[model samples]
Target: MTQEFGSQSTTDEVLAGVNLHGKRVLVTGTSAGLGVETARALAAHSAHVLGTARDLAKARQATSSVLEAAKAGGGSFELAELDLASLASVRACADRLLAAGEGFDMVIANAGVMAAPFGHTQDGFETQFGTNHLGHFTFINRIAPLLSAGGRLVNLSSAGHRFADVDLDDPNFAQTPYDPWVAYGRSKTANILFAVEFDRRHRDRGVRATAVHPGGIRTELSRHMSQADEEALISTINATNAAAGLPPFTYKSIPQGAATSVWAAVVADGDAVGGHYCEDCHVAAVQDGEGLRGGVRPYALDAERAKALWVLSERLVGEQF
Candidate 1:
């Protein structure tokens, strides 16, 4: 069936009449917001969902609604512990999944940290770059062997990638001054590049990867932002929109915010969407301006840059994938 869902499409709407009876899907950061909504919507279509959280108890509590939805849809739900800030925790999670020997139809790299004060991960990389990019990079690569043929990998990138491109020479900001938003942007850009290279390497094996920009939503991911930061962000957004001749910024409801992600994960054609950055349920155009509402930047999807970032990432993480 040919489907034409869009930015306003709800998760349930996208999956309406679709059957995922035996599909195995893994979604990270299920404790709240988009992750919870994404998992619930998939489960509501009878997909077996494995949702992760840094705190299992909180995840179980947060995903109670998901369990209820699963019950209603005759789906199943399970939980796993994951802390994206620690490579050790990432390895443990991958190890557990490996031991299960069960392959997934889809894997969604949905968990992340937003703009925060300068800090380092347990492995000593910049907090945002390490947790949002390298952490998922390591985990997904380790679990790549467990993806079923034709499986989909969805990395949740952001429109914030326009803030900065990946810095291959100093990804951790050891030499340069640390700027929270810039670091976050670089990490998000890495998310897109990771998907780009991943598609190139794995598409021949029937696996496809894509990055998604879930529209702006008032989620916990913004907990670190102070009032001043919020104001500055709004100003930047407005200026960018004005320059682009677009409307002022608007936020999506949690369900609405998750639409594109669910679309990329389950509804969109893998080959058509693979290696691209998507927003509003379609492959986004390349817009160069910073703080623009709805498109990816050219650098984010460059194949050569993707390859270079992959090599640099492997070296930084000290693991050859």
Candidate 2:
């Protein structure tokens, strides 16, 4: 059974009473926003956290801040290089980790770009699809060995996935007009599908995976959004929250936004049950409507689609496992 912690629950609250001494955690997109919160919370619990970012210098700065906070709270942290937009970078980062002979108790695939103007990664793939989905896909496969049995993997997905399915024929936007929201939706869907397939393939090995949608929070993640676009989204969210008699979509603080992820990683949920989509500090229920205003859409939970995407990903990344 899953429990719902409201938007008020902070990462520290979600992680309350859990002791993580000696646990090794790796969190991507750790330079800022919820990523930093995840890293900070983990480290604060005595977990040795390795945070990743695209820019080495920026990552160092961010790591320093997190480390300072961790130290203040009597915790520890480290930094690493990981650019989700570049497969080469992802592979290189994985190689570095492997070289260190370090084993991770958890790998939090939190790095991702949201709706951004049309662009491509260094690999010629569309930016959102490449960075949000493919890079993590390749990264996990590359470091699958370091994930000790019973290790956890968490993928950060979004409610925006209610918008679209993967366009297998044109995942890279090579033949079709690019819509940033649709691109983001596709990538987020890939995140969920990835966890489903990953759980299926690796659960027997005592490994498990989960996907999460942290409730909306204001953060630097909106940097790519236009002022108009941001205003529009905020209006829509506020309207929905108001209708629900909720607090006008103030939604979550950064620590709150990172709560569900921390909970999923450390909770003793009985033997690494995988392929679950979580939100608000618990596994979310599957919904069946199109244009789902809230909650996970059916398409995101479809087992068939999940498995199919796995095959497609394996083909794209050229990895046997």
On lDDT, the leading prediction is: 1
Give the distance in Å from residue 169's predicted Cα in candidate 1 to where it truly belongs.
Answer: 0.8
Task: For residues 206-242, write the lDDT of model 2, one tens digit per residue.
Answer: 8899898887878877788988998888787777657
Worst 10 residues of 2 by lDDT: 286-295
Q: Residues 195-271, candidate 1, lDDT per residue (tens digit)?
A: 99999999998999999999889999999998898888888888888888888887888888888888888889998
- Runs in model 1 lying further than 4 Å from the true structure: none
Steric clash pairs (candidate 2): none
